[model samples]
Target: MKIGREDFEAFINGEKSITPYIETDLLAGSYSVFGVKTASNPNYLIKAIYEMYELNLNKKLAVKAVRNLFRSVGLGSVGLNNLLKKLGIDLKPSEFLMLVFKLQHQQGWGAPFELLEATDKRIILRTKQTFESQVMKDWNMQVCGIHQGWIEGVLMAVTGMNWFCLERTCHAKGDEFCEFVADQAESSWKFKAEAIVKGESAITEFIEHKPVEGTIKLIDDPVVIMPRFVFTSMMNSLKKTMGEMPAGGVNYRAYMDMGKENVEHYRKMGITKPHILADMAFTFYSQMGWFRIISMEWNEAKKEKTITLEHTVESEAFGNTGKNVCYCTAGLLAGIVEGSFGIKVQGREIRCRSKGDEHCVFAITNKPE
Candidate 1:
């Protein structure tokens, strides 16, 4: 049946109107196999097709045209086979054909399965269309011919993130340095280099001969931005080690310090009970780590279904909160438990009076499982 965007979205979200096997088979085609029958629920199918294949469609109708032309020439099978082959998809011809038909039209293949994989590699990179196209157009008009380079610089500047290839001659000098010219084979670098090599000499000229105003402005950050630079680097390191970091590094760092200090200060006020500190951490202190208690229960059984962990956590307190403790207690415990014992805590709780608070205590919890 045809699927609409909403239906596709539902199916993708793990909504259960359909069976897993059906969903799995449909997604296997990369959502580019839609035909007469699957077109019945056009809306959901279309939605899924677009959602699943949308990123692939970023470049132009070129992909659609290519696929359609292949189909028209009785090479749709060949084209689908080619894509599936690239994706390492192995399925029977009948099974693969059914999926191919669903994907060609339905667009509801949301699983990040072969469809997204095929389309992302095949389409997104070559496309000039993106959410920023309009913004780039307006920016280009405003700054004369410096629009493209300027927009790229602005993007780097605004995001406070850096991208560089290992072998690039130039790298972001610092957090705010923002631009690099590297001769590397990374995907983004290749795109930039190829764009320069093939296109209007403007992009190449712009990069080689920097735009004075843009260059100066990109590097000219105030003194206040230094702490931000440090915090960003720290967060990036943390995120790389873990899977992700809190969305806002600056806000998260500030609050985390505050939570640490609140505990320290409270202890200085002569609080000594662990429960009080745990309560404080749960209500106030734990916010900094961007932590949320996933599941905390007293495991009474002899922990067979558990493991151990260990790691060093930079400790902070309210007074001069950014300062890391010589040795952090809670972080130490978590590292030991998760790393060595193979037991993961929903979070950690600890009591320390080193920084000043007498009854200061805190718990660091994992965001969620």
Candidate 2:
């Protein structure tokens, strides 16, 4: 079924029914998919990220970097394949790919998937609309890089070929639809090299080019912003680059710093109670489309707090991989508590959704004596 802005509005207003899978979570804050957490992200995030890249690099490289980032993190819709398997769609490669696309579409990844033509070596695909196009309609730039890279990754995984897809038309640029053409690459290395090369170039450009505004004032963060897919991809890239432990540590530290940065904001609002300040993040991030806070229990006498999150953004796209793939959020929760109380607090992920837990839970406590 097509979900329109009015539908979203009605759903938000409690005037319409929503999928049971996400009704409670959506009320609590955020969305979930097949027991995995997803987000109702805003369309502007694509533009915001594009702006970040554009400020440092040329538009071509900026777009390429975003595309490759998604490409490398491809086909991450976690538990859908298992569901598709029950339908006995595991035989034909093309059928497998199409089914995956269909499921992704249903999950709001994009519009319905239409396969225009398919050959042994090439395939052409089209979608009338995309989540990005809804916001980027007159931007004069093709902004559906996620679709381009996502299709390429899934094709490669299903066909065991180094598939590369190029966008021919994008609704973001006011086209009638978004179209992509995919073909096998000479080698997987050739297919993967683009991201690596462009990434290196982006790094150089980051240092050389003048940056855009460093910060912007906000009344409150947007309720829907970045996708869980992007969050998972970022964790994946860090894992690939720095190895799991270091990646988790670094990612944790960065977000902790980020959370601390909000100290002034909370102080300005005269929110001084650590528990209240720390509790506010759950709502803040929920509005930012991170995940739904399941439970928050605070123990004042012990100077500790524990949080359980049902919509695990960082782990939703990963299947039961048996790894602790979420940490940055833990740091965030802890950082806010520290800043709120102006005390040293440590955050730790006691349980992770990536490790097959039903929820991601963390704890913040006064630093050890």
User: Who wins the lDDT comparison?
Assistant: 2
- RMSD of each candidate relative to the true structure: 24.8, 23.6
In the range 4-110, model 2's lDDT, one tens digit per residue, is 44543443344654464343354678566434566655567777876777786666666666766676556563234444455443435555566656545656665
Query: How do all models score by TM-score?
Result: 0.17, 0.44
lDDT for predicted candidate 2 compared with the true structure: 0.66
Residues 99-119, candidate 1: write the lDDT tens digits: 433343234321111221121
By TM-score, the best candidate is 2
What root-mean-square deviation over C-alphas does model 1 reach?
24.8
Candidate 2's C-alpha runs over 4 A off are 1-23, 26-30, 77-79, 86-88, 188-369
**What overall lDDT goes with each candidate model?**
0.31, 0.66
